[model samples]
Target: MIKVVKRKGKYLVRQGHTRFHGLKLAISEGANIPKLSVILIDYKNEIEEYLENLDGNRSNGLNPVGQAHALAHAVSLGYSVEELAMRYQRSTTAIRNMLKILDMPLELQRLISLNLIKKTLAIEIMLKYSNDHKMVLKHIEGFLPGVKNIETTTSKIVGIPEHNAAGAGPDTLNKGGPEKKNSAVTRKTLGIKRLSHKKTERLKSEFLELVESTHTESITNTQTELKFGRDSAHLFKNVNSNNVIFSNDGVQIILNDEKLNILLSLLNDENTAIIVSKPKLEELLEIRDLLKEY
Candidate 1:
């Protein structure tokens, strides 16, 4: 499809330049192509035009980094997530998911762009690990598909006999009961006890570090608070008790229709000293007027 823009009193090709050129080449060779499709779009400014141009170019899809960049650029151009969703023909949730990619560490982004980490895997890392760059990277490093397969195959290759090679049956290997016997058998067959205690302690330490790092680094960044978790739990405790919180996005309240009507009824009382920001007040006033219309 060709998107044309009005320029110099003529409809000019704004998108699908390659397709246009291909058609032109076909025409030059006397190939009969009677059908053509075109779409005309109007934009008030160059930024809008450029944004559409960028959208047109993304029909083939983008890598995770490019997706994040595009979403970020659209936001920088004063587009809301809802607006971007409409423009891109996507759900607001999808647009928000793309925006989340921007909050990831640069190293993770590089890995994603390089395709060393799949986008689905990266998203899994983000959701499971949150904002811990080191832990995410470490997990990626230790994700050995081939080695895991080999280990499983090797275990099957070394078949288990009625008695172990050391002449120890399940009953003889563990006197601690069935669970213990199973555990003992697994340990003996896998030779897990051969790993040094020092190495085990080191692994435990690294795991604790990963957990601590995830906690510390995650809390300091307000992105999660802005996204999934509401910010300042202690500070907003009182506000939450009222079942509502005012934010830059506007007021979000947990109220039934009856409760909302009761609150609206209270709005007309002379003693109610409601304090709200200008934008919020405007929204409330609009709502009040809208209620009158109903």
Candidate 2:
């Protein structure tokens, strides 16, 4: 049935657009048409309900980009995304992705028309090429033919300018302008100070004493017969600093140097404890569980 809405005696197509076109063609060819079936809807109110069927039926012959343009048009006509999705029988995310196609450069939109790129690939290229359709086309023309996967090919685009990296390009990067006063990052900006060699050695000695006084007794006495979990294959233990010790069963971990000056400043405080490694904590937890069970 060719669905339509009569507005001021002028019938507007509401559904079955393909059927209506075919019916017109049949009439033009002198074919005898006795009965015509059509459903006339209220033009003022039912506009949103059946908008997808107005242009040759969205589910049948309309390409994705075409549908995206239609969706964009619907959005411009004061229809909400949710309303469009429901009327078009599409998920909200899918509808949004489709609508995104309309904003893309025409070349990328043409790829969508050619069925070479769908929503996912279009988005990937949008981010990867900084939405530069010329770069996208160059990549596709130069590399996409011999390659089977477009994403893997595009990801490996080498010798490309740093401008193409995600969210980091153009005005954000070095633009050959005068550098700002605080442009260079330093430890002072990161809440850590640049310590002199002698001061650093002094802090390390004090931290070694602190670790020894805090953990020597318990760590030396810890011996577990039952090991429920596998030991981590790689531990980030720096063995060079004898003055900064964090040893667990012969594995020594180094504390971050940024906190050294702060820790040395508060060495005499009684309530501050520095818990370091996962193995030590897990052993303590297992001991607690065993105590509860007993």
Candidate 3:
């Protein structure tokens, strides 16, 4: 039933907008809305309470911008975090995040209202570049190539150039290939001791072995499951969670089957998150030394 307040011979709808719109559509289609029901209200007394409750009872299915506006209105009406959270059926943290959406740059708000960008991405831009709406738009244009006139930042891709990625052409490599003659010279110029080829190879091999031994899914934002392997049990043990997985927390490499990509997950936040202390600190230093030398 539609609830409305009658004032000066006109009605102001306070709820059931969907039903009212449906009645309009039905009327336009030459169909009967004979069973329409509405509750009358005393405009002077109930309107304020009705409006307040309306803002607080916003449906979660509303658009992100609508949700933000409704939540913001609730906050402005002296609604506490706990009250808003309960009314919105969300956590207090989620309510805070919703309110934060209004504080984002105006350009971001527009994009969100138009559904061009997501709420989370908008918040990320807001956090990164407070009010730099130009930069935020430029960054957003990168992920959405179809959006025209955004003047994307066009950052240079940091990898092998397409022409050199694979080359059988003449300019690719001269007869002796690139020279390592200057490699040892450059090391000497930096006052660093250069290892012999045999020693370097041995060190590299050992470094790889150590990396494999220390490989674990205990690293942050990374987890692995044994899809199918004969030695899956041992693999799982090496990669499983442990309060003290290593003597020192560092970057751990996680290999995934998707595109055979190797992911480097930082395990650096040791003091509070991951318990990282043991008698095997020397091995970790050995890994560090090999990394430094290489």
TM-scores for every predicted model = 0.41, 0.42, 0.39
Candidate 1 Cα outliers beyond 4 Å, as residue runs? 6-12, 27-40, 114-116, 144-294
In angstroms, the error of model 2 at 220 is: 41
Model 2 residue pairs with clashes = none
- Residue range 1-294, candidate 3, lDDT tens digits: 677666568875656666788899989999976676888855333324433435433432445655666556555656677977786587676776677776765545544544555676565455555446677556655554423332212221111111111111111111121122211112233233779999988987886765555444433444453242433334445555542133232323334443122322233343222233443544454344434433
Q: Which stretches of candidate 3 lie over 4 Å from their true place?
A: 8-10, 21-36, 41-61, 129-138, 141-294
Error of 1 at 87 (Å): 3.7
TM-score for candidate 3: 0.39
Name the top lDDT candidate.
1
Error of 2 at 281 (Å): 33
Which wins on lDDT, candidate 1 or candidate 2?
1
Candidate 2 lDDT tens digits, 93-206: 667667767767665554455455555566545555656777766665453342222221233121111321211111111112112221222234223356898986686666
Model 2 C-alpha RMSD to native: 22.7
Residues 159-195 of candidate 1: C-alpha lDDT, one tens digit per residue: 1112223221111111111121111112233222556
Question: In candidate 1, where is summed lDDT lowest over 10 consecutive residues?
Answer: 168-177
Angstrom error at residue 201, model 3: 35
Cα displacement (angstroms), candidate 2, residue 284, comes to 38
